[model samples]
Target: MIEDKNQQRTQLSDLGEFGLINHLTEHFEIKQSSTLKGVGDDAAVLKFENKKVVVTTDLLLEGVHFDLSYVPLKHLGYKAVVVNLSDVCAMNAQASQITVSIAVSNRFPLEALEDLYAGIQTAAKIYNVDLIGGDTTSSTTGLLISVTAIGEVEDEEVVYRDGARPNDLLVVSGDLGGAYMGLQVLEREKEVFKVNPNNQPDLEPYTYIVERQLKPEARKDIVQLLKDLKVKPTAMIDISDGLSSEIMHLCKASDVGCDLYEEKIPLDPQVISTCEEFNIDSTTIALNGGEDYELLMTISQDDYPKIKANPNLTVIGYMKASNEGMHLVTRADTRIPLKAQGWKNFND
Candidate 1:
């Protein structure tokens, strides 16, 4: 909410467009053999040889998708790449390359972009992906990032949302609802800061939820773990929207319904406690709270033995005929129709 008046700031105009791009990307190293030419060329050149390729792209706006007051530029940059890569992972593929493009207002200094690129570089190194090519330009808006991620997978291993069948088990990786609760905490703190600038928020109790909102990691490891366990999902989707909407997506795509057990939906202790403090239902947050980024899929019942003992996976329900309809089976033995009340930007 406040900027230091005495701190130095460098304008972006001093380096121009090309120079700025070069300066930001100079430290990015090419780690993938699939990348023939990266960064400097007219366009990135990639050869996947005999492997099939998967491409996923996402655009995030400043005001619409993020708030600079809360989100650090580095985390924003890292998250922009991770979100796209998660889509590739949803297809059961190995992420190999990414192209990052950003539009920013002249108010951003060159150092600010350095922080953003540093985060991008860190993600590239940590995820073992190559930063190939992208474009940068001026903008009237605060900041926006567009990332296109490229991944490689074998033809037989590639999974789609239409492969789920009746009698398959619904499973999810990691927990849910933490990210939404984290956002709630941040929003509350932001309001408090507005009232009193000297009031420093004590976020010690909300550390898990805050990190969930700020820096979310894609489930790339789960993809590899599935391969090692010799279990391929029948239908898969990342929980970017909300559990209900994503579940509905899978059901519609595969033409099958589901009976999601409320008790079985994985949620962290932090989420439950925060929900109590805010007077919101934990189950509702788990269903409609978006940005969990966990993997949700249907697995053949025969393959259930493989993932059963794994703590990372949970079997929450089973798929049924579409005529049966989608419902959430409550703890008291009530079956309620599921609804998509998650993040719908267009509605706003």
Candidate 2:
């Protein structure tokens, strides 16, 4: 029998903060050996051996970062954790632990929060990261989530954004623009829903793009693949804020220029179709669309041979001298200056 989602709704006041915390986190077991001490303590105790530790944190707000009307609690929780882990992977590290803190208003039922934690637990299991400790608190308005991911990497294996040189090859893991296209689809459906509450959305056609936006997987496998291929990236960053924005970040940090090939930028078939349906430029979408969570890295020219045959990666561009200036070479051979037009959370 199908479970009724609304059949059992418990108020937040039914379980106080402490009781709620224990109830939600009871299922998480310690799986990481680095975790000396987990939950139910003043603080989490961790021990990293000889390798260097890397920590990354992210804050997700209801209206600012996400919309509950379309985003399910579970997917939000998973995405929240995955985004932080993506940062760790960008450094060529293995994420081992996470601390998830959440604040929710009284409007949310205990079951809703359980759904959120279910997603978090699933992400922790799949990513192989232990949820050590976190805090649960009350919020006056909407829900909020904060996640901190910790990982380890050898000193020599750590990759930074400022290491790209003039001759380094710019490579990207997976295609871009699908997530942004997915957001467009969701927003359109949301608008349609507002007009006709009884209408069901036909999301089957946009399943791939929708999943790209709602549940993005970090490039953890890409990191391991790079290691197996013996390809050490000179510089790297997770593509959270569009390819153009990330490329600019790498260029500014490394004091170099880039020549991104418009034809070479990868785009999923769904992304292309959606762009056409929306009357938007596919290249523009790829450049400015954000939240792909793919690894953007610069590898040495000598390492090109190793990655050339790798289906998981694509060489989109090549770095150049700072004096050359960053430009996008059009398919027609026209060189146009590249600009960052990614999302600005503060602009609205």
Candidate 3:
């Protein structure tokens, strides 16, 4: 029996963003002595007196984070590790080990599990991280993977969201927006396949970009390089939420402002061409398109030469006083206030 819609309950939109977060999390409280802070920042920080530990976990669902139709089991396994490791790297800590938990339905066979484990082993080897423990369980639905990563750092070496100082140079590792473009290419091909299954996708043209999306290499090397170079980023975050959103995080957490240049945002030639092919603004893609998994950070101006000379790094902008503003400066010399367009699962 259908009820009167006019007499129905309150909508989620009526609660708004902060209201939802508060309502959902209000019931939970930190119960562990080691838990320094929880669910309030980029990553949960824990202290053990002599040393500090950073803990982060991520859950990737079958249809949401990936589509098995196009993604290989091996790549899926590796990506599962990469996503969690990316978070540890963002905290400016070296990942040491991971615990992988999988929940799979009866549809997946033993051979498929072996293939997935093989990929996980490969990623563990590549990152020099140990797979210490995990849990395997049955599921009523599709595949679900959860990974919890652990890393250690000296109490002084740990960097958090609330550390950015004014005048720091905002930098990022590698290029941006390639992953979004890659997804666009894959989705277009999937549509083509739906129309006609026999048509082979010309994925060769987008190998690099597609790989960027499918099996991204974690920026573990960059974290190691920063340690070797003795450059501690004032504040740091990863690019999973799009550049605009991440920049806002750094600003809000650190009580600072930022000025990012449109031109300085790194873009590979392939990404530029792909954006043109799709008739989308590359700048917009870099700003709001998510899941690049690159490092977004700020360093001291004196440390600029260190990051500047490195081919792996790109100086895209600078931090400013909190009262100034956070914005993007276009090539036309127009300055527009920055805004976050982060991806939302609920909205989709």
What C-alpha lDDT, on a 0 to 100 scale, does residue 261 get in candidate 1? 99
lDDT of 2 at 156: 94
What C-alpha lDDT values do all the predictions have?
0.93, 0.94, 0.82
After TM-score superposition, the amount by which residue 28's alpha carbon in candidate 1 deviates from its true location, in angstroms, is 0.1
Tens-digit lDDT track of model 2 for 213-271: 99999999999999999999999999998999999999999999999999999999999
For lDDT, candidate 1 versus 2, the one ahead is: 2
Full-model lDDT, candidate 3: 0.82
lDDT per residue (tens digit) for residues 1-348 in model 1: 423343567899999989999999999999899999999979999999899999999999998999988888888889899899889999999999999999999998887888889889888988999999899999996998999999999989999999999999999999999999999999998899999989988899999988888888899999999999999999999999989999999999999999999999999999999999999999999999989899999999999999999999999999999999999999998999999996668888
- Per-residue lDDT of candidate 3, residues 1-348 (tens digit): 111223333444445444544443344344434456655465555655566778899999998888877777888899999888899999988776677778877676655655577777778778866665466667788899999987767777777878889999999999999888998998888888889887877788788899898888889888988988899998999988789999999999999998999999999899999999999999999999878899998999999877778999999999999999999999999999999986688787
Which ten-residue region of model 2 has the weakest summed lDDT?
1-10
lDDT of 3 at 23: 44
Estimate TM-scores for all models: 0.98, 0.98, 0.84
Predictions: Cα RMSD each = 1.4, 1.9, 12.0
True-vs-predicted CA distance for residue 241, candidate 1, Å: 0.2
How far off is residue 193 in model 1, in Å?
A: 0.4
Off by over 4 Å in 3: 1-50
